[model samples]
Target: MELDRHGLLSLYKTMTTIRHFEERGIPETGQRGMSASVHSSAGQEAVPTGMCANLSDDDYIGSTHRGHGHCIAKGVDPKLMMAELFGRATGPNKGKGGSMHISDMSKGMLGTNGVVGASIPLAVGAALTAKVKKNGKVAVAFFGDGASSQGVLHESMNLASIWKLPVIFLCENNGYAMSTPSEYGVSTTHVSDRAQGYDMPGINVDGMDVFAVYDASAQAVARARAGEGPTLIEAQTYRYYGHTVFDNPLTYRSQEEEDHWRARDPLKQFRDVVIPQGDITAEELDRLDAEAEALMEEAVKFADESPLPAPVELYDDVYVDYPVDMMKRGVNMSV
Candidate 1:
């Protein structure tokens, strides 16, 4: 799939935005003394950027814990996401759903799941809705290699295949599922190889290369939109940080391994490919990098200035019609 200049630039912009958001937001969590678990997707920007590039605001996407990239790529506002992480009332979930659960229904981003492989069934259900309505929309399920082993994934795939649901089963195989390496957990050499059992096309691509991921996802998305059932895509990628913010990756993986993946960073790889073609310049990329940094700075400011959710409204979203007076009375009730 050949992308025009505008498409190429957009891809670069989205990837940079995700990278900057993760880089800036993770530290802010620590500074705020937030106990919420944040799984950084710094090294896996290309996977979401490429996949979501093929989707529209109406297309649905179910995300995993390491889903900041997925949210940004799917067009969720970074400032609102930052506010959510900061536990502000202005957040998409009104400060209730933190890092792992951040969701924006307006952008068609189904909530990011904290459970392994949980997003798979959600995406399948969305696809079934699209198929029933004949809405011409597709859904995507983003999961990690660790979640690939979950029974829900296999069950979703089988049902999607039989029902011909318009969904893409995307696996961001970041070498490790938490601390356990893919080789130790997955029986197959590539996770995509498992697609055979479900009678779907399995594709494995270079997750670090945005172009490769974009091309593969373009085909898979097209297939789904054409009512050809689901496609399984395994992106061979790596994560720079640990499973969560507090975990240290060095304990399980070597510094050399981390350095190897960092060298092939998605942003750098995009530059290496585009600059040589003479259509896009290094200065242009640098400008985009600067803009992304500035954007994140503004997002941080927005989050910092935002107010926390009021204590009395705790049950507002939880109950459809809970009485306000009951909330006030409950607030004063002794335990």
Candidate 2:
């Protein structure tokens, strides 16, 4: 877990990229402009960026609704992701699956789910595939504190443990599950504590620190590849915005609480900890910031200029095959 200068620089740049992308995209959700619902991963950038830093393109990751960071960290092109959000034909799913369901199989992103706790089972399935194939790849499922209560999560955990599937259950404990806090919904003291029931190693981490997440994930990934069972990691973080872009968190939580987390802003902490210590210079960090902002600006322009799905192509990507006559009707029936 010894850090190199290059590794620290990549972490800093990736976290900044995720934060900037979410900031630009999620703000368009007020009904005045954007096409789809946006769930911001503003404050929680460190978790995915750090975890995914240890992943390869062949390693699978299942993500939550607020998964722009996960996608970016998993080596997906943000331009394509932004295009998907804009609902353009050039998008990842050609505008069919928007913010909630964006995916890139080539990069091993299973897909971001709109249904809470849904990705856990999917990640287990992906890990099962890897295990059966004997591929040296591990699957990671990124869920929130709310998903910790779902039956599917436990079932997935149990199955993975019994089969010794190469999977990692990562819970981003951001305090609240929508308007309701984790204290209100979850009976467990911490989400990682539930891992004991499934006989897996449970770890609690500071999601605000990228290095911590990377180190823990590296160990879990090594264990899985070595034919060991799954591990559950609960990252203690906070969401800077409301649950969704439309909801105002002020009604449920105090500004003081929000301000407290803001003071520990992951991006700022990275700079403060690394720059003065000489791991990275301010000039290099600024260059990365400029590059990220410029990249996002280009993604917006590319999305704006891209075309929408054509009428005759409605059946495209819908199914493997269908009756010629049924498809010729230019209608969508198979939901």
Candidate 3:
């Protein structure tokens, strides 16, 4: 698929944003000894960027633990996201929610959770609400191959297909679900094949190729919007990092495997394809890299200086209404 100038630039910007943020943000948050670890999507950038290109700000997205890519693709602010990762008072969830639980409801980012496959049902429920209200909004669930084994995901798919809900199930098949290979954990060779049981359209796409993923996800998004039904998309991509900061990848996969995937990096592929096609120049891409780096630096500074949440905030944002005296104690009732 030949992307227009705007589309190419948007793809480049989003992929770069995810890369830079993961490269820097993870270490910054980890170094503070916050006991926080990020499952960085270092190499698997194209799938989320391409898939999210088919969505609007009003469309809902539920993300996985390694979700910085999805968040950036869905138009999340790097500053606020960095703040949330840093657990600062100025974060999107007032620092209450960390990396695995960041959410921006106004932007249609329902939330990310640590529990594997939890977001699938959440996305289905959101899609059910949209369908019932006839809102014309689609809900997306971004999960990893590891999540495919979770029972909730299958239940959600059954419910979604039965109701013909406006939801897209995207499985980022990054070879391994933690330390276990997809071949070992999953029964099917292609995750999309499992969609047959639910009677929905199933598609398997080359996730490393942005255009391919874009075309596939665009079709699924269009189908959902037209009230056709849900679509299950399995994007075969690879991540360049260990499951978390603590895991030694050498225990499961070799340096050669990591290096092999890194050699076919998504950003490099996009540059090779788009730059030669007259859509953008190398210098323009470099400028974008510089701008993204600067933006990240500013975000880090903001997070470093921000205050921790107040003691009283522990009981806040949990419910629509709080205790009467707690609200009267200047608890910022304007939520």
In order of appearance, the predictions have TM-scores of 0.96, 0.95, 0.95
User: Mind sharing the TM-score for model 2?
Assistant: 0.95
Tell how far residue 301 is off in model 2, in angstroms.
0.8
User: Deviation in angstroms for 133 in model 1?
Assistant: 0.3
Model 3 earns a TM-score of 0.95
lDDT of 2 at 111: 97
Can you tell me which runs of candidate 3 are displaced by over 4 Å? 322-335
Name the better of 1 and 2 by lDDT. Answer: 1
Which number leads on lDDT?
Answer: 1
| Candidate 1 per-residue C-alpha lDDT over 11-86 given as tens digits, one digit per residue, 9 for 90 to 100 | 9999999999999998997799874489999999999999999999999999999999999999999999999999
Runs of candidate 2 with Cα error greater than 4 angstroms are 29-32, 327-335
Per-residue lDDT of 37 in model 2 = 68
Span of ten consecutive residues with least summed lDDT in model 1: 326-335
Error of 2 at 143 (Å): 0.5
TM-score sort, best first: 1, 2, 3
Candidate RMSDs in Å, in order, are 1.7, 2.2, 3.4
Q: Which structure is stronger by TM-score: 1 or 3?
A: 1
In model 2, pairs of residues that clash are none
Candidate 1 has a TM-score of: 0.96
Candidate 3 weakest lDDT stretch, 10 residues: 326-335
